[model samples]
Target: MQENTGAGYPGDAGVTDDFALAGVPDAFQRLWTPHRMAYIKGGQHQFKNENDCPFCVGPGRTDEEALIVYRGRTCYVVLNLFPYNPGHLLVCPYRHIPDYTDLTLEETAEFADLTQTGMRVLRKVSNAAGFNLGMNQGVVGGAGISAHLHQHIVPRWGGDGNFFPIIAQTKAITQTLDEVRQQVADAWPGETDAE
Candidate 1:
């Protein structure tokens, strides 16, 4: 006959084993950032109007302050404040418009040109393995700032997707926005004769 010791059993409060007392630590390290609360809350207040639109306001500020990588006549490229990746860029038209179809012929041309140039510059500077390029049309379509039209140029690398973003809801940005902006700006292609 055996006596009950409450060892290695479920709901056993009497377990005195060291392994049971102190659970095993995970091999992975965690980066806990409470500061992201500001970013989460700030999203609601960012696009109330054209004046409040970051795409609209970014061009007016200095290159360093605005994180502007390149400025075209009708469109410009700026670094995403909350980037999916370090070199994430946004190509936005100067005119405040909600839809892509609202762009004029000139705006459309410049927008397309800037988008391609942005990808090229990002590849040159960051050595990106791939890219996630597109526009989130409206609020329902995953656009954070749906009031203004902007195309996202997210640079992706091998093994860039990881459990941290999925489990912790936190993205680890390797470089500062300014550092990435400078790198891309420095590597941007010079204006061709056709421009």
Candidate 2:
């Protein structure tokens, strides 16, 4: 066994680095990949109106199931199909407007509620050390689904990093979305569905 570096890492001496980690997640940095970012670009289909939005789809659509976690008359939360972290999620108003001004006062309050709920649930399930919360409002601002503005709430960890994004350019996820979904779903029931 190798001695720990006392810097929070085990010594590398005699350590046979397992390449299989590339598949199973040995480092958080390798998780970010071109395929992932390309999808994050969120510019596949351009719609002249908000009607073309997938987030706007009804729950009964029977297509790609809307990852709606919490739903109210005006606002709700959804799991990000493409995520920056395990519990990455989106909070938005049901109204199909890109401009933030379109959301009513009640809807904004619900949005705040959803954000708090999402953070609480993420903390319970992932044991996450931190979070990255923001909104990408347009193509110029990194909005993939710019037609309808949504807030992204990303869960984070302290050591969930490596040289990949700075070097090889990847971000490795140590947990599976399935596992993440299950844990987050179970953490606080209503984060996925409103109480």
Candidate 3:
């Protein structure tokens, strides 16, 4: 048996020169996002009913309060509270319908219109190189809020995917939601042709 020296390995004689952790060197710099704990703890996505849904309540609030980028007659564009990347937006119908096929003819038209407008605005504001646009259908399909049908508009840059997301399972968002919301809202076109 060896005595625990407290400063180093049990066999070492209080010599921690080689094992010091305080000054260890590494290539990565941490970007602490304590705000994400809420989302992780289910504060943001868990809703008991449609009345408590963020998408349903968002239309009643001010644009800034709800982080809304653009509003159409039947659909609207809002920033994802928990975004996969910066400038990520969601185009949703005002109605709290779960599936895409549930959309009315007018809602469907406006939904498509808003999605195109979202892509255009993202390109104009953030110079997005490409996009990942889709909807996760239900809980089994990776939809965090499956009760609301929202199409994601994720802006992709050339090298946005780095070692962090793959190795550490952490995505570093460069902009605050408020900042993104304001920029997207300000850059939104006054009118988009709806079909």
Clashes of each: 0, 9, 0
Pairs that collide in candidate 3 are: none
Which residue pairs does candidate 2 place in steric collision?
30-171, 30-172, 31-171, 31-172, 32-170, 32-171, 42-144, 69-192, 69-193
Candidate 1: stretches off by over 4 Å: 1-46, 193-195
Name the candidate that leads on TM-score. Answer: 1
Score each candidate by Cα lDDT. 0.84, 0.71, 0.84
Of models 2 and 3, which has the larger TM-score? 3
- Could you tell me the lDDT of residue 79 within candidate 1? 92
Candidate 3 or 2, higher lDDT = 3
The residue-by-residue lDDT of candidate 3 on 13-69, one tens digit each, is 444675353477577777665554443445435653678988999999999999998
Which segments of model 3 are wrong by more than 4 Å? 1-48, 192-195
Q: What order do candidates take by TM-score, descending?
A: 1, 3, 2
lDDT of 2 by residue, 1-195 (tens): 667788755566734566432345544543445654675565646653656677777444532256555566678777788776678988888788786667788888878877888898888777778889998776667678778878999988886655666475566766766666566666656434564
Instruction: Estimate the lDDT of model 3.
Output: 0.84
Model 1 — TM-score against the truth? 0.75
